[model samples]
Target: MSDPSMTTTGTMTSTRSLSYIALFAAVIAVFGLIPKIDLPFGVPITLQSLGIMLVGCLLGPKRAFYTIGLFLVAVALGLPLLSGGRGGIGVFVAPSAGFLLGWWVGAVVCGLCMRQFMRRMPDAKGKSLLIAAFLSSVIGGILAMYLFGILGLMLAAHLTLVQASLAVLAFIPGDLVKCVICAVLVQSVVRGMPAWRLDRD
Candidate 1:
């Protein structure tokens, strides 16, 4: 197998890593298809973002970002892979589009944080990995998600910043839960198959 972070030339493997990226993207779409809770705020709480966190932690920052980019491309292609089986460009115009767009940034940020912390710690056990993953999800991923989500809400729902923030409060609990779930799952994967992490660089 190849390091997802590098190419045959030993440079960053942006192009060659597409296969792994596409695989994770398909996984995201498939996870999105499962029936899930939809908050009244128009943001559906799905496993897709949780999956995003795993890709970030396990695949490292670059590959994780690429995977999420591919996932968005799939959604943009009218795959009906989003929550509630929604598809097409209209999804981008929807209120939850901010969250969708944030997926990329969130994954990248989360991956970066994991890489930084994991390096300092060097041997993150299950507990350490869980804590690192949790913080990464909350500070890096969810924050980015909310930033984009709030912007989307302001535009799509036609609310002021304050109003949008208040409106999105409904999603806080669900997002926290999702973050926890993601952290645990990612830690478990690391413990079970540490080799699966394609690139630590």
Candidate 2:
């Protein structure tokens, strides 16, 4: 395959990139259809974050950011693309808005880390992929999401940091489950279907 970094000058090049962005956006949205569990704390656990991390690891930062941004736009436009099939402007304005916003940042962070890992481990071993997936999710998805989520929880719900922290703590078990799922899923894909290994590019 040709190098993605090798830019060709023309309108067609931009169009192709846009097409990829759209395809990835659709990927995230379609995956949103999977089962979602809403916690009592108003934050729901969904597979969309898993999709976000996977897209980032495969598509790189710029593409990953656009993919997630597009997903958010669709949700804002009343599409049932969010957890619990919830959507529309109301979702964006809700207390969970911070997490919605954080999705894009998380994608970028995950993509950057994935790219760096690929660079560092050009001929990565199986165990390395698992570690990369875990670290990428933690640093990229969880932490980034937590920061924005806590801030939004404080602002939208009028809760203090301590209170919000306790509330958000409710999702720890779920988040860890997601992390485990991410690692296992990524490893399986990369090992079984080498074509899914985006690092070769």
Candidate 3:
């Protein structure tokens, strides 16, 4: 027979994990509420990506991916949880769909990068945290997202690859700034609240 104590422990762990996932999902939704800056290409820039970066850095890969997945599910269900109160299944057919989908992929990549960095430099501090966070965010948050965003533009907007590439250039500067912010915030948490270090989980 299964041990009752073990079953209870497992249930508790699952509940805790679910709570964390819900919390991060809410964070993404909150970030999405930030006003968006519409660009000439019809794509708007928003702070939601910053939330993705933070989730990746703090939750690690598996949990971050699940968190993002939950957020996407909510948006798909017609909840006004995306930037500018956008949501519903129609979003999947929009020009930004690729970027939206990219959030999950990016979070996974970012989480993997963070996990590797933490393993290699277990005691990363100050500038080290910044360096780690920046590189991870660049690879996962920016590069991965661009790949999907470009594809989205090409398919949804019927733009040529070159045009899509050009369109994405406008977002690079802002994404870099977000990377810096994510890195700094992560470093602050790591330094000030050791017990809350998500990587340790």
Q: Give the TM-score of candidate 3.
A: 0.90
Residue pair clashes in candidate 2: none
What is the alpha-carbon lDDT of model 3 when measured against the actual structure? Answer: 0.88
Relative to the true structure, candidate 2 has a C-alpha RMSD (angstroms) of 4.4
For model 3, where is the 10-residue window of minimal lDDT? 192-201
**Number of the top-ranking candidate, with TM-score as the measure:** 3
Candidate with better lDDT, 2 vs 3: 3
Candidate 3: tens digits of C-alpha lDDT, residues 66-165: 9999999999999999988989999999997999888999988898898888888888888988999988899999999889999999999999999999
Residue-wise C-alpha lDDT for candidate 2, range 17-67, written one tens digit per residue: 689789888878877888878776667777777777776776778888888
> TM-score of every model?
0.84, 0.82, 0.90
Residue 66 miss distance in model 3 (angstroms): 0.9
Candidate 3, backbone clash total? 0
Residue 39's lDDT in candidate 3:
62
Give me the displacement of residue 114 in model 3, in angstroms: 0.3
Comparing 1 with 2 on TM-score, the higher-scoring candidate is 1
Clashing pairs in 3: none
**1-201, model 1: which lDDT tens digit per residue?**
886655555544555577678887888888888888777666766677777777776677888877887777777888888867888888898887888878888888888888887888877787877898888888666787789889988999899999999987877778888789878888777778876552364
Look at candidate 2 and tell me the lDDT of residue 81.
Answer: 81
Q: What is the lDDT of residue 54 in candidate 3?
A: 87
